[model samples]
Target: MHSLNRLARIAAVLYLLIAVIGPFSIIYVPSTLVVAGDAAATTSNLAASTGLFQAGLVGYLIIFLAEIVLTVILFDLFKAVDHTLSMTAMAARLAMTIIHGLNLLSLFVVSLLASGAAYLSVFDPAQLDALVLLLFNAHDLGYTIGIVFLSLHVMVLGYLVYQSGFLPQVLGILLVLAGLGYVIDSAGLLFFDSYLTTPFYVAIPIAIAEVAFPLWLLIKGVKEEALPKAAPQPA
Candidate 1:
């Protein structure tokens, strides 16, 4: 039981690390460097901030590696509740992580295009700029697809948490809502041309649920009394 609680805390720490590290690549770098509908300008920005762009790539890699470890820890923590469901959740999260890691290749292509290398000399500056923008858009689409898988993971993990008895039920409910929000937003991004133009309140549940869950894990760990007892060994 004590070991389980300790594992929960370790998971919490890793979750917190991901939360802190993710936004630098996902939010900060893009907003800092990408210009909407201006391919030349965006490429110029990338060239000017090569160090920052590289840092963003490193940040993404760190998050990807962390997610791999986190997936295993979570599966262990929840497997006693329902082994199959825990495995399902772990699988979904792993799928999302793989998608994200592969998606970085697009960004790497963008970086190479921005490098002004001799090998790229065949392409005109205008062509290179357009290619950079296209790769960036492709990366965005891939990220949305990854989010769909993450939604599945969150929803399944939420169900496990609700059934486990060792964790707070409210967190489980919030996670389900958050997962639903992710699904809705991902659908919008994939299907609707005007999705980004419209105002959306889906972020509220996502923010609250993600933030609260990790904080709870860090502070409360798990309820000792509610943990499942190990089966007795043969005498």
Candidate 2:
């Protein structure tokens, strides 16, 4: 059981890393590559640019798959905590997990559409219009839903971390910030069109903290000496 618990924790960490870092890095790299290239490039150069874009799309799909695995393993770890939280808190966490899983499926569909469009672009640009429309609309909607649920999930996670004593309060604070950043970014994209890009920067730190803190918790477990004991009160 101890080993199983440790494995679950490790899986959760890997999932978080792949899901957050993989997609972000992939997108940034290809975009940078394209921007740094010559403006007046040949068909081959364009093809290379497209190839970079395709790589990012593939990376997004990989991240989605990792997210699914991470969420499942985290759920298992939550069950292993051996601590009882409020019913509302438990429900919130479960809801967040379910919503995240749904978001992953939505992302997977978007990636498939993107991949199809990329392949079709090699033949004719006109062929990709419908796929592009479908992919963008789905992505926008998915982002909106994901941000809302993720915000709630992070808040719940903060509370859980506070109660667990196994995880640090600072980590919980970071989760809260990350959740708020998502909400702000999603809203900005939907409504403002132009706003501070701070959320994007905020996300990098949040992602790093998320992977680090959870892995630490899983490996070290709670500080046995620091854990508070449950007290019996009036019924």
Query: How do all models score by TM-score?
Result: 0.95, 0.60
Clashes of each: 0, 0
lDDT of 2 by residue, 1-235 (tens): 4344465467656655675666563346334433222322222233445665556556666665665555455544444343333333345544544554565464345345445554555645433434444443454455466556656656566665656565677777777776677677767766785653546576775676666666665676555445444433224
The residue pairs that clash in candidate 2, if any, are none
Clashing pairs in 1: none
Badly placed stretches (over 4 Å) of model 2 are 2-8, 19-21, 24-26, 29-46, 80-141, 199-208, 218-221, 224-235
lDDT of 2 at 42: 23
On residues 1-235, what C-alpha lDDT tens digit does candidate 1 reach at each position? 3388888888999999999989899989988888989999999899899999999999999999999999999988887788778889999999999999999999998888887789999999899999998998999999999999999999998898898899989999999988998999999999998888323578988888899988898898898678775433334
> Where does candidate 1 stray beyond 4 Å?
197-200, 229-235
- Compute the lDDT of residue 231 as modeled in candidate 2: 35
RMSD of 1: 2.9
Q: Which ten residues in a row have the lowest lDDT in candidate 1?
A: 226-235
| Residue 113, model 2, lDDT | 40
